[model samples]
Target: MKSRIHPVSRPVVFRDRAADSAFLARSTVDSAKFTEWEDGNTYPVVDVEISSESHPFYTGRARVLDTAGRVERFERRYGGAVRPLR
Candidate 1:
């Protein structure tokens, strides 16, 4: 392996505040925030909005879309002039 060419990898903590969970992993990214892990070690912490913990697919919580209501509103506004594509 070449030396002094690749980005250095360090142990960092990825925190998912929405799910109230965190995990330690090695990455090249760094953060100003720091946190203590369960293993009794302090590492740089990065706040993430979504992860496997809170994701819809992983958590099996899909968002229900209001498709029918939207279609009715569009038709009422445009007088249903927009015909369906053949």
Candidate 2:
């Protein structure tokens, strides 16, 4: 362990705008904004676009990609130039 060489880790609030969720956690990330938490204390507010609350995988709403269709489209456009592997 070293002194005066480590980042300051403190409680910060991560806000997920899409899911409207906010939580407090300790992090070393820096932010210029602040907000009062539920405990009536001010903490740095970090706005995030995606979190567990808003992530498609966590919410079980992930979209399945049609790989076959995409491959077919690519082949249609560039199949003539690409030589078949033997």
For every model shown, the clashing-pair count is 0, 0
State the lDDT of candidate 1 residue by residue for 1-86, as single tens digits: 99999998999999998999998899999899898889898999999999999999899898889999998898889986777899
TM-score of each: 0.69, 0.72
Deviation from native of the Cα of residue 37 in model 1, angstroms: 0.8
Total backbone clashes of candidate 1, pairs 3 or more residues apart or in separate chains: 0
Which candidate has the top score in TM-score? 2
Candidate 1 — which residues are off by over 4 angstroms? 63-86
lDDT leader: 2
Angstrom error of the Cα, residue 22, model 1: value is 0.5
Residue-level lDDT of model 2, residues 1-86, one tens digit each, is: 99999999999999999999999999999899999999999999999998999999999999999999999999999988998899
